[model samples]
Target: MYTPKDFVESRLPVLHDAIRANAFGTLVTAGEGGIEATHVPFVLARDEGPMGTLYAHVARGNDHVARHAGEVLSMFTGPHAYISPNGYPGKATHHREVPTWNYIAVHAYGTAETFTDPDRLLDLLSRLTEQSEHDTGQAQPWKLSDAPADYVAPMLRGIVGIRIPIARIEGKWKLGQNRPAADREGSARLLEQCPGDNEQAIAEAMRSV
Candidate 1:
């Protein structure tokens, strides 16, 4: 991540929030077959380690897990939107403004390992289901126990679990931090009026900053 000084976000709490909010991340690994990437939802354990840990899974048929070694990179992307030059107050004065993009992103680096134990796999599945269901406000969340053991057992056998103990994390929130105060305010106002959810989110972030 090539983040400028003004856009860098190093606070662990902020990084954790971004990871939790955008749990679906791209997992990248380099091996003999070159680089392979997989998009998957992750479960972040904020207090599990000095730098935290991430949990996810891959299909048994996906051979990427078998080749995963050393350090892996997990990228989480948050709200992003286009900012037009028209939104900058200085555009009218000097015509120096240009269109840009604002976004929030987090990159986590860590050692990745795979687990195939049935017990651990079942526990991982259960935790994933619970967290997803809770997020959706389901009154009666679905459970692995809802299905017959024979059916669930076979299904669980089809995937491999992954764990990454984060060694380092970096976050970038490019929310007009480099822009002048007046220009940032103008951009936020224009973005807030836009109908896109991402634009509105950027507007809110700008205002908060």
Candidate 2:
């Protein structure tokens, strides 16, 4: 999160968009056992608080579930790619540019709490499922109700619901904004020709910036 002034993104809507687009995130917390991190998919409630609220879950047996009531950090990573100096227009003239990375990331800080109520957990699961299914663009998206209630009940009981009302948030879009306009444009164009999805995504993000 060491963001330079040119790369800092504080807009609430922009931060929220990044979180929604990259829903899978790492949740970090410090406890007696030191720092622990869990990777999970999160659901954002944009209007739930001043910043927003995050919803996710961990297995009931997970140590994280036992140490949930505290300040925590959730990190969402978006598209990223290696920026080769060869792509820089200035490289040919000055040979001063070095390789760097371009990426989008958001960090959310909040106090986390756990819930065990069956109804609330069920609602959380439904929302998570609905969002994921929508992203898959399936004609028949699956729902929690599609499964037998008895089977789903046992599954829900095996996990704990987590809710974090965001206290603060930070977004960093390291999309070569610090470079000269010509260099930035040149790098983005080169990235678009790359084969990977991440390279293409970084290129698009750079152009939009």
Candidate 3:
């Protein structure tokens, strides 16, 4: 990310929250065949490493995982919305404002490894399912053991589990931190009125700043 000084966010807790809320990330790696990317949901093991560890899986047929090695990146994107120039209160005076966008994101880098053991894969699936179900407020959430072992065993065989021990992390919160108070407030009001959930989220973020 080409983050400006005003938009840089290095706080660990905030970065972790961003990753937790946006568990799905774009996983990218470079190999002999050039670059490959996959969109997948991740499970964060915050205590596993200095920066934290990431867990996810890809289809058995996905050649990207087989070719992946060395450093890889996972990008988590949070709330984002367009800021129209007309929303700026100063636009009437200066008439020089331009449209911009506001958003939050995090990038994690680490060396990735694959897991092929059936037992490990089963554990990974169980944890992932549990996390997702719990986040969605399912009082009686589904579990891996809910299905017959014979069915799950065969299904698990068709995927590959992956682990990334994160070495570095970066976060960016471009929520008009550089803008004047009046402009920020005006844009936030417009964002709050927008129908999209992300736009409303940006409005909330603006208010906090």
Clashes of each: 0, 0, 0
Tell me, by lDDT, which candidate is best.
2
Candidate with best TM-score: 2
Error of 1 at 73 (Å): 0.3
User: Is 2 or 3 the stronger prediction by TM-score?
Assistant: 2
What does candidate 1's lDDT look like per residue over 1-209, in tens digits? Answer: 99999999999999999998888899999988899999999999889999899999999998786786789999999999999999998888899877999999999999988999999999988888887878888779898889899998988889999999999999999998887888889999999899999999999998877
> Candidate 1: global Cα-lDDT?
0.91
Ranking by lDDT: 2, 1, 3
State the C-alpha lDDT per candidate: 0.91, 0.93, 0.90
Predicted structure 3: lDDT: 0.90
lDDT winner between candidates 1 and 2: 2
Which ten-residue region of model 2 has the weakest summed lDDT? Answer: 62-71
Write one digit per residue (lDDT tens) for candidate 3, span 74-174: 99999999999988987889998899989999999988899878998998999899989989897799999999999989888899999999888999999
Over the stretch 36-79, how does candidate 2's per-residue lDDT look in tens digits? 89999999999999999999998999858566557899999999
Q: Name the TM-score of candidate 3.
A: 0.96
